[model samples]
Target: MMQAMTAAVAAMAFAISGQTAPGTTTRPVLSKAEAEPFTPETYLRYSGLYSAPVADPWRPKPIATGRPDYLVGGHGFASVQQAVNAAFRDGGAARRWIGVLPGTYTGTVFIPAGTPPLTIFGLGRPAEVRLEFTIDATVTPAVWAEQVNAAGRYAEGDPAWPMFRSCATKTSATAGLCATVVWAQSTDLQLKGLTITNTLLDTVDRGTHQALALRTDADRTQLENMRLISRQDTFLANADDVTRIARVSVRDTYLEGDTDFVFGRAAAVFTGTHFHLVSSRKAGGGVIFAPNTAPNYPYGFLVTHSRITADAAYQTAPTGYLGRAWDQGASATGYLPGSTPNGQLVIRDSLIGAGFNTVTPWASAATTARPFTARIDEGRDLNDVDHNRLWEHANRLTAAPAPAAGTTTSPGTRR
Candidate 1:
């Protein structure tokens, strides 16, 4: 067994269930009913591997009520901000735990500066009722990006104080462009057991813009059993060498998106998770991951012991990927000689359902600069866009050989 120390003091468990799905190139659907009841051995039967630091504690906290400057329900306060604000309000330094209840509270959440390194543990079983947020990019992109950026140690020292406001990326305007959800800039923050979903994507509500779900811009942040689902450009692991999602562990979670959903310049391990591909009209299935790594950056995305699935109709078209490095020559930040250099994305030892498009994976304009055309046509010839670069990885951990080249999951073949 590998040390599995992909995370510090951490053990990653990657497990899949049932059998393959019909029409798609992925494993079977998990039995939600049987999975609800947890046992020591089969705690995460539905999703396979279980992430500890589990939400075993419970406190029925009040919601949409209560004033700050007072601890509510448990620990610091009722609102996440209130609790965070109270922690650094007096500039006193100490770690604390914020216990949040299970509820579908909807609104934009901003984690500002002075955020103490802490843990937001849910009060119930997994996925009970998640605290979901939806915010517009044009309205608060800068504020969104600044919150996490504040927690970083800038070479310039201290960095700018965080505010729930926008900044300039377009025009002469200094406001909203890189908005994100639940950005934890402070180190040692651990969030376990919640569904963080519906994040506004890379597209701005007004025009060209960027959106994201949770961004661990600080070091030593842990998200255990939390589902990060969104459209394009979902989770941006911005922690680099100096910082990292340092010891970041995403265990037994589900990450879904359409185009380049998981992109960033950070190194993190994604173990025992299901990465689903949303639909795109183009011939190739939607691009699952596009990792933009800084040259000499030590880490990148490591996806293992999970399954890859796409929407029903597109399985034959090739949905999944061992991602190609996104080194767009003109991309301002990732501008490397001719392309952006990226750390490896090893999708290893897991099942690939039919939902994954098996053919023409690396056949995109990002690499070829021309529209894709199927030259090989249903033949195992040289015309197929070579996958040797994508599949022939040195670090990809292996579990089992995929069923076969063209095995489709049906009720009979599905276990």
Candidate 2:
């Protein structure tokens, strides 16, 4: 059995390395460029991803004020997964609230599709209710399944059992998808006042070890007053299908990491949030956002009225990069112009504190290493595939470094 699992993992890794493997579907590539020429009007159009009105008021209410259908910690369910399983058993279309009391809950939590809409919030402050685990991207799916199911939280008949099985059967190409502490695949899912951390910070080197705190692959996912702490690939706002639109909204949250921390293909909006770049990764600096928006998707990632700050170690020199285009699955030389996933991001009306390279904040593409080139000087379209699609408008830099608390000062003064 161990030998069979090892062979399966090896096959998956080989398949992920670009060879066509059985049961693996290749991402569709565009034969011709269909994207409209980007202009100020284009930016306005994409901004609708953030400006559009949402169905529900994406806010968190105190647990004391409302009655939660299920509870975790204290005299409640032994684990968050147990409470979620109970909610799944009492299946309904109506929203189910799960109030999590103060304490640290370890292990993976997978919220599968077809479950009732959920609002999982902490009773105390975000720090007081922590959900954390440590798993790097290099682990195979079989091994990951053993570790996650060691406590038997997900039984064979559990509602989330299939979800766990799906992740366990993933190949090396999708192994990173299994490293998340909280993987939410249900629409209208709300998480608030909690800290989801992946404690794989210093275990591995500052390489491609991706340990995600939270990964949302559903539409209308709302996160408020939450903290996602990790090192690489921390918070993934992803869509199950690249062709389908998935939207996520994060408000008043704190995300801390080093490289490509906030990344994915979802149309995600961050408002009044704080992004802290830890300097413990590499000597120079690290990247923050790595969006792999589809070729024709107008909306990618929008960060407005937020603060992107770095640690005090970067006070003397600027090294951090604002973002990079994640041309996923593209070879270093075989990247197609209109076919590959081009990341689109806009940082407007935000505070970009010190430690970022002012001259060239954006970096090269992740997979293809495509150089960052914007043609604003030549008045060319911003979304042109030839140039990187990262743009910033009305973003000011802070002359002062981050404070001792690791939060950036007010954006009142500009550099």
Candidate 3:
């Protein structure tokens, strides 16, 4: 099955590479009222698995009982960046642990590529230790640098200062890349029991602005018991390059956002997590996941044993979508399938709440606005790369029941 799917994807890529004209065939777009209601069993029977076995969960070893290598908050260090700088200066391939006490540290943290194996964890609950900022994608790099270095947090002698300068000198085309509150580029990085938030949720209108809470661009990154909050593009599981593999394992975490909250191109697995979709920007509802997986790379995202819920406002109306493909760098008219990045995602053994659209859960492509076309609907083999690469298997949904005060209620049964 896997070999056939790979051959099909490769064949599709080869076919589109030589094609000059758009395909003539068109699939019928079903309306919300006329579309058939979504059934888990029926959907799985048609849309076969587009997933593979993920790597085992990776986690950083717990800090020893003695004083940590570096400490943030209290009398240790003024900011998390300071501790990270100290770690870089005391450079070695050995693991370095930085324990953060209970306090909110507001700043943009940039962990450079050459840092040693590092783990920055909170001493208390995730809510007690916060690393937050409010910077949107529209901000220019120069303006972002000023805001980030306003308090003189990053001094000239600091090892992170040069890294910050490198990021600040990015072009306007990559303005959105600098809006991350915490960006880590070191391999074997781990974050635990902390809250990272981008407070740009209500500052700007609901548009294409992306404010990332945490962006990891390294391999073997693990996040445990963390809270990531934002609006669009909350937590990015990124890679240094498309060819290089970056695997992130997020376990027992709480992620909250409105649109495309969890997105990126890395091979990420989210297990035992809670994905909360807020209704603050309810104009067009919201999307939960957007994976921009490379054409050749099979693994994109896998969400297993997780709960995906939405605000109470969407319980009755059901306006949210499960996810959509982020066709990054695809042209408006010449969106050649198989050649371009086709996102692949699988949500198995999970509980999808009542707020998502029952009939058409997946939305159109994020960048090219390509209509959501599934290979199964076209009578082709499953995992055909010519269409949207989204699939689900053995998933369940919550029953439809009126929500109670400050809580969403479900019928005593699972669908």
Candidate 4:
């Protein structure tokens, strides 16, 4: 078996239950009925290769709430995979609910297609419902293969290697080894009050360190009070290369990252959210959003009524930009597969902290000759109309830097 250090740490044990309002005088709640009244325990069965949870001293102990139709951390399912398997066993369209009890889940939780329309809600605050995973993109697949083969962690013909390879890109040498903490691919799904983090420890080499915190390709999806954290490519709201256009609405969420943190081709609406810049010292600053909206698409990223703030560390840099046009013809996949860069975004009625670059607000170039589209419509934005393809509508900057013609890497930088 591979050493514990090579693989993700183990975690388990939690239950889903409700709590009374603050300062409420209501009586104590009743103990949950572990077994459902009519549903067969067999009905909730699913098939998949099961990995035992490794022992991690820091991992939180599971909480056992006796709830039916719910998988508690410690008492019910040993892993979130099992719970998801059970939920999608029949692949029916009936509405179902999965309550995640307070505890940190450490592994990948995939919501596959054809699953029932489901709602996964955390029991407590976002912090309390934590789902964490780690995958360092700096490690090449050959290195991973050699290490895993030497460690003897996985047996021959195991699915781990193939799945790990699937995470990488066609051009990445470490292709098939990139890690995505959460992959949400089902439609009509809802996630509320959860913190999904990618704890890949490679802050030094930010180049190929593409640790994704969450990748959502679901349409008509809703995210409420979600805290998504990672270093690069933190949250991807995009569809598959062949799927239909993705539509998502994120409300009351918190997103933090460094390079192209919020980049995708989805028609996403972010409302009342907080975008934090957690760039490293060498990064100077980073771009927050990189949208690749097609010309025919009406909406791309509509960020309104949100706050963009920087940590004390990130404030040291000149400032970060709001977003850039993600249109790399050769590198672009997913929506608008090979189309020219036509990124559309609208930041309106938002409070941008002083940590942003007031001068060159958008990144002008990613490569030597490849510049972003210079004709981003101003629509009704109040800021100066000099910046290329990046328009703002009633946004406030803190540092208030002098205005400039174009930018090298001022507001947004290349990935």
Give all candidate RMSDs, comma-separated.
Answer: 13.1, 13.2, 11.1, 17.1
Tens-digit lDDT track of model 2 for 86-130: 887898899899999999999989898888999999998788899
Residue pair clashes in candidate 2: none
Runs in model 1 deviating more than 4 A are 1-78, 90-93, 112-114, 136-163, 166-177, 199-210, 240-247, 280-284, 316-322, 332-340, 363-415
Q: If the candidates were sorted by their lDDT against the true structure, best first, what order would they fall in?
A: 2, 3, 4, 1
Q: Report the lDDT tens digits of candidate 1 across residue range 141-238.
A: 34534443453421122222333422323343333324555666676666766667654543333233345667766554566656676665567775
Per-model TM-score versus the true fold: 0.60, 0.81, 0.81, 0.68
Candidates in order have lDDT scores of 0.46, 0.74, 0.73, 0.57
Tens-place lDDT per residue, model 3, 207-279, is 7888999999888788887889998999999876666667777877888888888998887878767788877
Count of steric clashes across candidates, in order: 25, 0, 0, 15
Most lDDT-accurate candidate: 2
Overall local distance difference test of candidate 2: 0.74
Q: Which ten residues in a row have the lowest lDDT in candidate 2?
A: 20-29
Candidate 4 error regions (>4 Å): 1-68, 140-172, 176-178, 201-203, 331-338, 365-369, 372-389, 399-415
